[model samples]
Target: MTRIGIVSRQQESDLARIPHVVRLVEDAGGTVVAESELRTADVVLVLGGDGTILRAAEGVRGTDIPVIGVNFGHVGFLAEADPESLADVVARLVVRDFTVETRMTLAVRVTQPDGSVETGWALNELALEKVERARMVDLTIGVDDHPISSYSCDALVVSTPTGSTAYAFSAGGPVVWPNVEAILIVPIAAHALFARPLVVGPDSTITVVMNEMGFVDGELWCDGRRRLAAPVGSHIEITHAEEPVHLARLWTSPFSGRLVAKFKLPVRSWRHQERP
Candidate 1:
C-alpha cells in the first residue's frame, strides 16, 4: 500500500478540506501519514498555495520523496490539482501515473567577520535586503571570484531558474523556464545607473559582499522561510544545490501552457489560428 504524507495550512478553511482528502487517499488503498513521517512515504500531498508547497519541499529536501500540490490558496503556481480533483489525483497516485520534474535549488552560505559560517537552502530565491527602512544597503557583487560591480540598493536577489518567476520576477528579473539551468540576479530599487538583472550559468558561483561602511546591516532570507543576520563585511556565496526539488506532475501539458493558464495571459490568437 502507498503511504501518502500530507501537509496543509493551518487556516480554518484549509483545514476543513483535510478530511475529504484523507478519505480519497484511504479509498485509493493508500495510508495517510503526518508530515513527520514524510521520509518514509512514497509521495507527499500538499494542501495550500505555493508557500505551502515551498514548506513541503524544504521538509523533503535531499530526499527522494516527491511532492504533489493541491491548490487551496490564492495563486497556486506550484499546485498541480484542485480540491475537486482530489479523488482523481488520489486514484492516479495509486496507479503510478505521474511524472516527476526536478527543479534546481540554491545553496547559500554566509560567512561572518568572525570566521563562522551559516548555511541554508532555498527552492525559490535567496534575498539580501536592508533591515533598516530608511537606509539602502551597499553591496559588491562577484561571479566566479571576479568582481562584477558595486552598488547601493534596497535589496539583491539571487535565484535559480525555478525561482525566477517568484521574487526575481517581482524585482524586474526575466522569467526563466524551469528546464533551463541558470541563475538570476536582480537588484531591487538600485541607486546606480548600471543596475540591471543578470542571468548566469548554473555552474557559476555568485557572491555578494556587504560593505562595512553601510549605515546598517542587511538580512538574509531563504525562500522567505529561513532568516539570518547579514552583518557588514559579511560575504554570501550562492551556488546550485546538489539535490533538486522533485515535483510529481500528473499532466503532460507543456510549461508554456501552464504559464499562460496560471497568469491568465491572452492566447486567443493561437486558438484562432487557421490550420491547413
Candidate 2:
C-alpha cells in the first residue's frame, strides 16, 4: 500500500473538504499520514493555494518526495488539480501516472555586523525591502565578487527561473521559462537612471551590500514566508541551492498553455491563425 501525506490550507472553507479528500485517498488503497511524516510517504497532496503548496514544499525540500497541489485559492498557478476532480486525481496517484518537475531554489546567507551569520532558503524569490515605507534603501549589488551597481530603491528581488512569475513579474522582471537555468534581479521603484532588471547565469553568486550611511533599516524576506532583519553594513549573499523542489504533474500540457489559462491572456487571434 502507498503511504500519502496530506496538508491543507488553514481557512475554514479549505478545511471543510479535508475529510472527503482523506476518504478518497483511503479508498484508493493509500494510507493517509500527517504532514510531519511527509518524508516517509511516497507523495504529498497539498490542498489550498500556492501558499499552502509552498509550506508543503519547505517540509519536503532536499528529499525525493514529490508534491501535488489542488487549487483552493484565488490564483492556483502552482496547483495541478482542482477540488472538483478529487476522484480522478486520486486514481492517477494510485497508478503512478504522473511526471515530476524539479524547480531551482535560492539559498540566502546574511552576515550581520556582529559576525553572526543567518541562512535560509526560498523556492520562489528572496527580497530585500526597506523597513520604513517613507525612506528608500541604498544598496550596492555585486556578482561573483565583482561590483555591479549602487543605487537607492524601495526593494530588490533576487529570483530563480521558477520565481519569474511571482513577485519578480510584478516588479517588472522578465518572465523566464521554467526549464531555463537563470537568476533574475529586479529593482523596485529605483531612484537611479541605470536601474534595470538583470538576468544572470546559474553559476553566478549575487550579493547585496547595505550602505551604512542609510538611516533606516531593511528586511530580508524569503518566499514571503521567512524574514530576517537586514541592518546597515549587512551583507546578503544569494546562490542556487543544491536540492530543488519536485512537483508531480498529472497533465502534459505545454507551459504556454498553462500561462494563458492562468493569466487569461488574449489568444483569440492566435487561435484563428492559419496552420502551417
Candidate 3:
C-alpha cells in the first residue's frame, strides 16, 4: 500500500467533505496521511485552491513525491480535479493512472550593493512594485550580464512558462504553454512605449536593479508568498531553478481547451452566423 499525504489550507472551505475523501482513499487500500503525519509517502494529495497547492509544494520541496490537487475553491488553476471527482481521482491513483508534469520554478536572489543576500523560490512569478504611491519605478533590466533597458513602470514581473496565465498575462504578457521552456519578462504599466514583454530561453539569467536615489523604495513579491522590501540599489536576480515541481494530473486535457473553459472565452461560430 502506498502512503498518501493530504494537505490543505487553513480556510478549509470544504472541511465537511474531507472525511468522505479520506474514506475513499482508505477504501482503495492506501494509507491516508496529512503533511504532519507524512512518512515516506509516494503521493501527496492536496485539497484546496492553488494557494494550498503552493503551500504543499513548499512543504514537499526537495522531495521526489508527486502532488495531486483536488480543487475545492474558486479559480482552481493548479487544482485540476474538483471535489466531486475525488473518488475517481483516488481510484486512478490506486492503480497508478496519472501523468506527472514537471513545472519550472524561479529561484530569486535579492542582493544589496554591499553583498548581503536574501533568497526565495517561486512556482509562478516574481514581482517588483512600488509600495505606497502609484509612481513608476525607475530600474534597469539585464540578461546574463548584458544591459537590456532601464525604464519607469508601476511594476515588473518575471514569470515562468507555468506562470504565463497568472499576473504576467494580465499585465499583457504572452500565454506560454506550460511545457514551453522559457522565461517571461512583463512590464506593468510601463511609461515607455518601447518597454514591451520579452520571452527568453529558460537557461538565460534575468536581473532587475533598482536605481537608488529614486522617489521611493520598491517591494519584491515571490509567488505571492515570500516578500522582501526592495531598498534602493538592490539587485533582484531571477533564474530558472534547478529543481522542478512535479504535478500529478489524473487526466489528459489540452491546454487550449482548459483555457477556454476556465475563462469562458467567446468563440466565433460560422454556423450560428449563417442562416440556413
Cα lDDT computed for each candidate against the true fold: 0.90, 0.90, 0.84
Output the better candidate (2/3) by TM-score.
2
- How many clashing pairs in candidate 2? 0
Residue 231 in model 2: shift from native, Å? 0.6
Could you give candidate 3's per-residue lDDT for residues 1-276 as a string of tens digits? 877888876765566667877898889988787787553678888889888888888777777778888887677777879878888988888777888888989999999778889888889999898976857688999999899998888999999987888889889999988988999999988877689999988999998899985676788998888898787789988999998888998778898877887678898763635568
Model 2 gets an lDDT of 0.90
Model 2 alpha-carbon drift over 4 Å, by segment: 271-276
| Per-model TM-score on C-alpha atoms | 0.96, 0.96, 0.92
Model 3 regions more than 4 Å off: 37-39, 270-276
Which model is ahead, 1 or 3, in terms of lDDT? 1
